[model samples]
Target: MKSIYFTIALLFFVFLFGCGDETPTKETKDEVVEPVLDYYPDNVGSKWIYLNAEGQILTRTIKEGEEFSGITYKMWQAEPPDAETEIWQAESSDSEAEQVFFRKTIAGIRLYTKEIDKSIMKLIKEDFKPLQGWALFNFTVQSSFTEGLLVELPLKPGLDWLVIHIRAAGTLLGGKNIALTLRFTGHSSRKEIITVPAGTFECIRVTYKYEGKLEIAGEIPSSYTETMYVHWLAPDVGIVQIKDAYGTFQLIEYDLTL
Candidate 1:
């Protein structure tokens, strides 16, 4: 729980200050073939290592390439593989940041959602089938798309997008329930030179704000937590650096086979 909490607080920061940028990808919306976004690399075998503010390091690797329903996805996970790690999806896009599909497994059950849009990534949609004791605390949910966004695309300095997300869930017995709705309004245009273990390069700084509501058992909580993120993305290399209050995930090594 501590690790999950830490990641949530950390990634939220990556969304607020720096995320997307100005480099035009090699592929655009003009072709019949898959347009590979130049700014984001989806090749298999790609790897990234980041050193946090406290000197602790986090690592991710593109284990393989996968295709789903005619769309290709680059599978990413921690350096040392584990069972609980989830696989994220990014469709082919030459201009905008690909929407990510969230997926993972817990205990011994599988769970995931299906919301397809190149610019949308639906989070917190559903939980895997319930076990004997897990369902009492968890709920099931359906669909809620406030709207998607435009990211990893070519932006001059002040372009933004409003991305929506909705999640619903219920207990195994269908008594208790939980739901959440969030809209992330993001804008970016700052550019900076970043140096990591991989190399030094110009990166687009993306930052954004998140606002939404949360409901559990049809009741709103008295207190709510805010979320934000700042990502330093390097064109041609993908996300080279992620920053937050705790530390940083700076790219130390990578292998994106063109």
Candidate 2:
């Protein structure tokens, strides 16, 4: 009887443990986390094409780096050039409407200014050929195009900062002195999902306030101020849409050759 009881107890224990082991296991799926996007990805050979409301096409490309005063700068060029030959004619490209060199700095992305004087001298040689003999405008800049932060990193909503402040005084025609003051303020507004011709993008909305004061030293001084808040920048994608006084430009295509 003891042997029979022992056998029955052993069998019950085996049945309980064996049944527990035979229970079906639940399957689990791995969760995928998306990558964090950079506000501005400055990879070389990256190109972006935009189409305006007026059917005008704009193209911007990130070209090779150029060395200036021991510092290398990435060149960003825009097509359909908007040349400002009247005052500041310093430029790195003759074919593009706008070409700006940028280098990373502790403060932010700074404008490369080592070649400013060189480009200005070149402009004097070509456009201002007559001013080569003597300095017509004793031009002095408190902070011109030399060092301006393009975009502040780790952008967050409601963040605002002074982008650039430029105060310059120059004499034109060797008599009349002109003074100019320009200030730019940037603000990171919010996060949005927007769709353009290029595609859909999760972007950060940014805005800039531009203020200009011009004194001609004779006529009525003029002051201009405007706030542009329609810039949509996608993470790892760059500028996706822009709306200004002219018109709206939507990203049509982009190639990021990172």
lDDT winner: 2
**Root-mean-square deviation (CA) per prediction:** 11.9, 24.4
TM-score of 1: 0.53
- The most accurate candidate by TM-score is 2
Off by over 4 Å in 2: 1-36, 82-92, 105-107, 113-139, 170-178, 214-222, 228-230
Candidate 1: C-alpha RMSD to true structure equals 11.9
Which stretches of model 1 miss by more than 4 angstroms?
Answer: 1-37, 80-139, 144-152, 162-164, 167-179, 184-186, 215-225, 244-246
What would the per-residue lDDT of candidate 1 be over residues 25-128, giving only the tens digit for each residue? 65643536544334555565666677765677666665544455664444455533211122222324221322233222221111122432221222221122
Local lDDT at 157 for model 1: 46
User: How many clashes does the backbone of model 2 have?
Assistant: 1
Alpha-carbon TM-score of each model against the true structure: 0.53, 0.66
Clashing pairs in 2: 81-97
> What range of 10 consecutive residues in model 2 has the weakest lDDT sum?
7-16
